[model samples]
Target: MNDVLHPSLLLFLGAAVVPLLRGRLQQAWMLLLPAAVIVAVFSLSQGTAGSMTLFGVDLLLMRIDALSLVFAYIFAIITMIGALFALQVKDSTQHVAALAYAGSALGVVFAGDLITLYVFWELMVFSSVWLIWCRRNPTSMAAGFRYLIVHALGGVVLLAGIILNVLDTGSVAFDKISPESAGFYLILIGFMVNAAVPPLHAWLTDAYPEATVTGAIFLSALTTKTAVYTLMRGFPGTELLVGFGVVMALYGVTYAVLANDMRRLLAYHIVSQVGYMVAGVGMGTIMALNGSAAHAFTHILYKALLFMGAGAVIHMTGRSKLTDLGGLYRYMPATLLLYLIGSLSISAFPLTSGFVSKTMVLEAAALDQRALVWLLLSLVSVGTFISTVLKIPWFAFFGRDSGLKPQEVPWNMLLAMGIAAFLCLYIGVAPGWLYSVMPEPVEYNAYTPGHVLWELQLLLFAGVAFFMLLKFVGGERKITLDTDWLYRWLLPRVVTVAHRVLQRLWGGLLSGLMARLRWLVETVNRHHGPQGILARTWPTGSMVLWVAVMLAASLLVYYF
Candidate 1:
């Protein structure tokens, strides 16, 4: 094998063949593929850009630049963590699908051309949908179909944009194309859909929770972050994304506050978290971009850790709703500890990975004097404080005990969560390890006294708010609105109303035409049918006389 076949490709393609084997052998391959990819990507990062051409278009199959490196590195780490968490799953198909899905994301990150990015993008859709359906339940099947439709629309937009971009420029290089053209807007909207930016984000909540416990962990880490990577690479500095990101941030928090399903709540928070990343990219400063990339790295770790903890709980107890779960600390202490770490990290506690990374973006926003954006970020942080850190662990693990006793998770699952947990705390205390891999050289500090004090006050006040309004916050109702409602409800109603108006106008025109036809038929019947001049019995005599005259005229003409 040549080195040109990028190591990420080797892992992805290798995983698809694993299902051909039987039993435990297949499981072994499943675990090994992602781990191998992690090692492969890390090693590949040390080299220069390696280009490959197919279909007469240059594809940057392996770009080792700093921006791509940050995303690719974290993707590999999350893949290993996900694979570890999924080790106990009996289904080889889910394992292969998750690995392929993660591998496809790596391919996109490394891709140097729009065509290459798109190829991997579509592959990502196909590979991840299988994970959603891994549960083999009717609900999952429906959710997967919806998920497919949303992503397929996104794919179409991306492909159309690429084609137009290539046609316009005579090259498909993956540089930031202008967002003025139809193609660029189409591509931006497409990327936003996957990024779960408000309005089109329902698929995350509807589909992710339906995946098998093992599959959801992998699903949570890849697709949205890939969209974030694309936005960073292509649409950074687009002013519209700042507003869009703010909307997603608030939208996610609102729905998450009302969500009952444990995983679904986390999925909503995913949208919220991505909003921060998107806004940072929109800021267009080196610090902001670095913050976005760094956050993506940390988000993948802690988010995957959170999902793994949720998956372990679901795996042991066969439950996922907060109302139906509580006091798991009595039965699964390891999982509780891991879940708390993920929660604290996600909440941006001063000494966790989230704090180290997320603050950079918010700090960047403040320094840039984007007062509105900074305010929105503050509100989102406070909201995160309410919905996730307080809401998730409190309800799922420490709420009223549902009196359910389930065994602790398998050793591999615990080990995976432990790895993620350790990293979260380790990075919280020392962010230098993550800062070093940023696309640009890092000069900012994460733990300044002022920054720490501000975050502490925000989080503490939010916690107080949650307790003061505890009676109003806890409920079983689901918030029924999102950006998806445009297509799901508003668009359909608009179409239906247009159809009704067109139907009425057409019906009136048809009625008038039919009436005229009826009148003409009646007139013809009176004039030319049995009762009309042409159809009456007297017409026979007139016809005979006319025929005689014609014959005479014809005979005279022939003689002449």
Candidate 2:
């Protein structure tokens, strides 16, 4: 097992080669690397490899267990899918950024210690930002900057926690960190930020919508999902995460319902869906943890499918807003069909991947008597259906015709989405294959008659409500600001006001000081000028007489 080629290394190496080759060779390299990673991940066993001591501390590079294997497997799978989606993309930089982003995420998953994890954690931020910026526009550039800043801050907090925790415990093992630890909150906030928990989640919605289509595919799958993997690894069962998780679920749906941008709506849903996994980690039951792992795996599949579908629309129509799109089903029949499969799967419809995974968390909540948690989470499913299943299709493809005649997406895009759609269905039909790879043994059945009945009723009623309230829920043309308003809107105005106030005060102070300096200089010039009385020329004899008079006055004063 130690002799097995490292999957992360394969991707990083592949990324380097992406620029050197051209045309078909580069494309071949892209698919081949992830293919190799798939083989490497499946070949992994439960062991630590690449162990070493640095500065008198032991470090583990590779920690292969059930949990790590699960993430690594999906990451490898998505990388290949994303590469295929981008096969028609001519930008070599995107291919490199995506590969490196994937590599770093895999590194985080397989990391055996906090040090290794932190290193890869930062790499994920730096490498992935390029995907957003590669769109090479003002909006994307700004979004990329914000994305980089937020994730970097998260990484810093995480690093601070790691340093403090290591000093307190004298070890850097990346395991279940306790709440009582000095660095616990810092570490939790750091993870929550990346997990797209609210107040810290603006970056994802802001940048992801603006990312390049192909890059968004990788973006949707990797960053936050890796954060979820870390939470599953390091902070399982921490009570606060339950609160954060539930908030994320509600917050995402609220903003999503208000969204006009197709990708932005999907981004908010990322917050919501990841919320399920976060809550499961907080529950910390074997069933809950298994649910979280399974959900993370399926989420990558369906979420990527959704983003790819949305991306294909943007690619074909050169438009992404719901207000700008309509009646596209006929032109892009294959796109609409594939997109609906992902939509249905994400909504947790019976016989979908979400049906199997999302229920485990709710069932765990019920078992633990967290009725409020279960109820709120169940309600979130209604919103999921309204936003993803009902709202997106109603506005974008099946609603009134927007009069834009666009062609279908290219074959590569369809093939890539086709692969993801197939997996979403496959996992749904046979949940056991997914459950078997869970961090723990999963015993829950998602297809109980009562369970299936409940899901249908929830979705059916939600669909009905969406149509009933259709007048108000239609996409608005105005900008929808999230917590990002603090920076994008409020903070800049604050800076502007401060700058103006300082400028006025400095201007007045400088003007007054200059006037005083001019007065003082004029006084000196009046006395010192050649035309002045003191400046008049005096004879040498008069100066000598004054000196003698001064000497006599000194002698008289001394005698007195």
lDDT of 2 by residue, 1-560 (tens): 55767788988988998999999998888888888888878878888888889998788889999999999999999999999999988899999999999999999999999999999989999999999999999999999999998888888899899898998888989898877789888888888899999899999999999999999999999999999999998899887788888888888888889999999999999999999999999998998899889999999999999999999999998899999999998899899889888989888998889889999888889889999999999988888889888888889998989998899999999999999999999999998889998988888999999899999999998898889999899899987878989998999999999999999999999999999999988887788776666788999999999999999999999999
Each prediction's whole-model lDDT (CA): 0.85, 0.91
Clashing residue pairs for model 2: none
lDDT of 1 by residue, 1-560 (tens): 12545756676678869778777787677667777777777876444466767778776766668888888888888888888888777787887788789889988888888887899999999999999898999989988998999899888988888888788778888878777554788788888888988777888887898998988888888999999999999988988888888888888888888888888888988999999999988887888999899899889888998898888989999998888888888889999888888988888899999998899888889889999898988888888878777887787777788899999999999999999999999999999989998988888988889989999999998899898987677648454566667766899899999999999999999999999999999998889887678775656888899999999999999999
Identify the leading candidate in terms of lDDT: 2
Maximum-TM-score candidate: 2
Tell me the TM-score of each prediction against the true structure: 0.89, 0.95
Error of 1 at 135 (Å): 2.4
Q: In model 1, how large is the Cα lDDT of residue 225?
A: 93
Off by over 4 Å in 2: 526-538, 546-560
